[model samples]
Target: MPHYKKTKIPLLWLRRHTSDREFMLISSVLVGLTAGMAAVILKTLVHYIHVLLAYGNRLLDQPYWLVVFPIIGILLTVFVVRVAFNGSIGRGTAGVLFSISQKSSMVERHKMYSHVVTSAFTAGFGGSAGLESPIVVTGSAIGSNYGRDYHLNYRDRTLLLAAGAAAGIAAVFNAPIAGVLFAIEVLLTDISISAFIPLIISAVVGALCSKLILQEEILFNIGQREFFAASHLPFYVLLGVLCGMMSVYYTRMALRVEELFEEYQSKVYSRAIVGGILLGLLIMLFPPLFGEGYDSIRLLEGNNAQEMLQNSWLAFFGTNEWLVLCFVGALALVKVFAATITIASGGNGGNFAPSMFVGASTGFFFSRLVNLLSFNNLPVSSFAMVGMAGILSGVMHAPLTAVFLIAEITGGYTLMIPLMIVAATSYAMVKYFEPYSLDTKKLAQKGQLLTHNKDRTILRIMKIQHLIETEFQPVSPEATLGELVEVIAHSRRNLFPVVTADRKLDGIILLENVREIMFKTEKYDLVKVRELMVKPPAIVQYDDSMADVMKKFDESGAWNLPVLRNETYQGFVSKSSIFTKYRKLLIKTTNVA
Candidate 1:
């Protein structure tokens, strides 16, 4: 022992000295820096791809090539997903949500970079989608894998995963506060006040990264907005209503198109070609639908209406302003199709930016239409700004996020009042028609969504198979009490299932019921197992949901219940085991560490 030398394990030594909170704070900074860098790389890649495609070879001058580029992008993206990545590159934020709810927030390691590569190819070549969702997935994977490598607990892993997502969004938009809200509103459910410190730190770090390195241009730079006009409150309310209705139509149409493509799931090429061709034709008609369409939104906010229509098929109509207005309005309606097809056709992207694009267009269209009527001079730029909040609120069902995001990204709260009004109204209207957002409807329907509710989340993570007690021995109903006594002596469980020769549950024999006669040797021969066995008041089916099983337990008032499948005795489900598992799952689901 005196001759041996020990090698110091730095991480383990640090872990032994540092507290959990200190470790989380350190992890948050690392996640924020990495996620921010990832976001920057994705943006830079997409920009270079766009330059190479549109400006490098005179592709912009060739309208046919512009249409063909997206098809090629979709093909490339599909190829990479199917071959290079083994078809594991997930679809944007939905994948993130699915992982948190169903997979314990454990994202596949490939996602950390797969989305950046494929989405760059898809949108860089002009697929009509946005990079925000892909960035979210990539960042989430980074944080999740980091936590896994460190062997952190589930709560810490999920917190870090969400921190990465917030960081990515903050870096992308240069809006730290909004980033925090987006993470809490969309990705997390049951956040404590203590969690806010890490989230805030990560978001700020990410935003600083974007501000310092990327120098991101202000997305909707509408000069200095006019002060809110109380007279225009009614108009804002009406805009909210219209945006809500449009959101419903948009949600339904997107799901419908996704279903249409899903039919060709077995044939990836068929799906890719069909969706790409349709999207290409749409883009050919409406060049503004070519990509995320943020350029067009900026143009619209700046009142460059003619420039917005400069390169579209609609330009053939005329230079008439009314014609341009009609074209812009039409783009608002069909952009949904372009965006949805871009994604449904196996492109890697999300509906976040597309929704904002639609909102801006809708707001501008409404304001222009009213101004043309001469009812009043509505501020087109302000309405366009608030409209972003309205549609975002409706589609994502996160009104606060929509409102604050609009306020923060625009670099001021000049439109906060209208933002709140429009966002709340649209959210309420959409909530009336659709109970869940586009990303969460399927998960909620399957009872897989883990909201902030601790009880439901605990129940959601508790699997019945893990709680099933298979050690309970079974005996034939035809056996004598002597055989039951032998089983009871050799077994540990107090309840013994009586089954037929076919393994079907005929009844059960409780040890307490035969406790006195169990040791009576004379009665063991005379009393048959069937004579003493009693039918259980209630039985649990193998496929029954936890909610239903809990209800059966309460109604039967039994400590132990028999589990059966098609009348065959499978095993027993004891209350003690369920309680123990519930406590463990509760700790796993709720513990912040």
Candidate 2:
């Protein structure tokens, strides 16, 4: 529900008149308008940057400047990050996922505009990355910060954040359904019926913003002039498989190269310089590897498919048909390198466009190869479009988003069957090899990712260190029963850990075992902690997962267990404490962002 007291004067009147659902619905429209405008503005900014370079600027009039511009973009972005943003700006979708997990559904205010500015400079100057991720980041931050200012809870705030993301994507692609699905599939762990209204409203509003504000040329729309052939199902299956393989390669290569650049974390300038130079070299060799590559993807559907070769080093040779095919294939393979360097070197961008670019190239190359080598003629444009779905499905692990997005952007669902087939095929194949998508992999490794599994997700967010109970008094094994009783008088906890002189966990003493002896003052001086204490049913390792902790709790059937670090007793972890923390976190994390 919208909080009137916490909010400003303008929204307080609406908050008083309407219920929670109505307020959210109304807010969804506002969020859509705002995020949609943001998306439109970002697109306009990139377009103007491109125009400034192409028409007005003679500095880049020379063809070779194409190679140099990406490097400059990287350096400029790095400088901006170091100076304007305090030398730290998280890049891509991973940062958003991290914010969702670690932050209580509250994105920093800077993210609302930071991503737009950085991505504009990065992509505007021909960095081989996509603006979609930045759009998502910016839009989500807007929603999150809005929710925070209005004092919304984590659930409603997260929903709004996703609405903003959906709005941004819908605006960019003019595909409302795709935007909603992308938010659902990629961002949220679970959803309720109430969530859909805001998502749908936001997406429609975003799409409207795109329709009203942006021209047809700046959009990512592709004209699908061909029909899907069931007879070509076998070819699509092969293409799906190819896209799946390429997706794995793309993910692995990107992660691997980013690791290489990670070594130069402290040396941002030298790294950017080297990475920029290499990126420029790659862009020089393959002009299509520059920027979002949407133009080149669009070009692949036409007779001038080879025309992308005009500004490239390959232009020295004639545009042979086979050479064009190979060139497209090379673009598919090497574009990841260009994108990885662009981002790893400190420029802001994402793999969304690169995946689509690769998929399109893969599809074009496959269809062209088939037509050249075999008797049957394949529809190159259809293959190119479906191939985009394939890569998006595999890379993002969002088959529905890829399917509907391609369908919506291309004007209709004429290729729905092929879209589904390729999307499903690629997703299945990639899943068998890599369980996590490119964005969530790092979080998964750190046990910070939220999944569809409610119990698992809750446990992943629960840290053992946070649940440890140190209030329980520790008794030395050599301590007499009277001394133990003295210590026990102060501690509220019934369970006690027995420690040696070296502070190693010798054993544990349950209150039930000591109840009989504690009252018998005659035996208090005679009994030692070593003799009274016995081995606990189980000991919890310091680094154990919360799931493992729960497992030990169940297996031992004990309410408390000793937590140990290198065999030394740190503290006791009680089932009650864990359950308390669990219930608290469960409320915050369930069906969250």
Best by TM-score: 2
Residue 96 CA displacement from its true place in model 2, Å:
1.6
lDDT for each candidate structure = 0.84, 0.87
- lDDT by residue (17-116, candidate 2, tens digit) is 8887898898899889989999999999999898888778765558688778888888888998899889987866777777776787778888899889
Reference-based TM-score of each model: 0.92, 0.95
Q: Given candidate 2, what's the lDDT at residue 472?
A: 77
Q: For candidate 1, write residues 1-593 as lDDT tens digits.
A: 33212222454565578998898898898899989889888888888788777778878777887668888899999999989888758777778887886677899999999999999988998999988899899889988987887788788999999999999989888888888888989888668899998888888988888788874443233354566899999999999998999888788888998888888888888788888889888888888888778888887787677787778776777668688778888988998899999999888899888899999899999988999889889998888888888988998888888888888877788789999999999999999999889877767767666654557655655666777888888988889989899999899888889888898998999988999888889887788999989999799988887777888999999988989888877888988888888787666555353
Model 2, C-alpha of 147: deviation from truth (Å): 0.4
Task: Provide the global lDDT of candidate 2 against the true structure.
Answer: 0.87
Best by lDDT: 2
Error of model 1, residue 446, in angstroms: 2.9
Candidate 1 accuracy as TM-score: 0.92
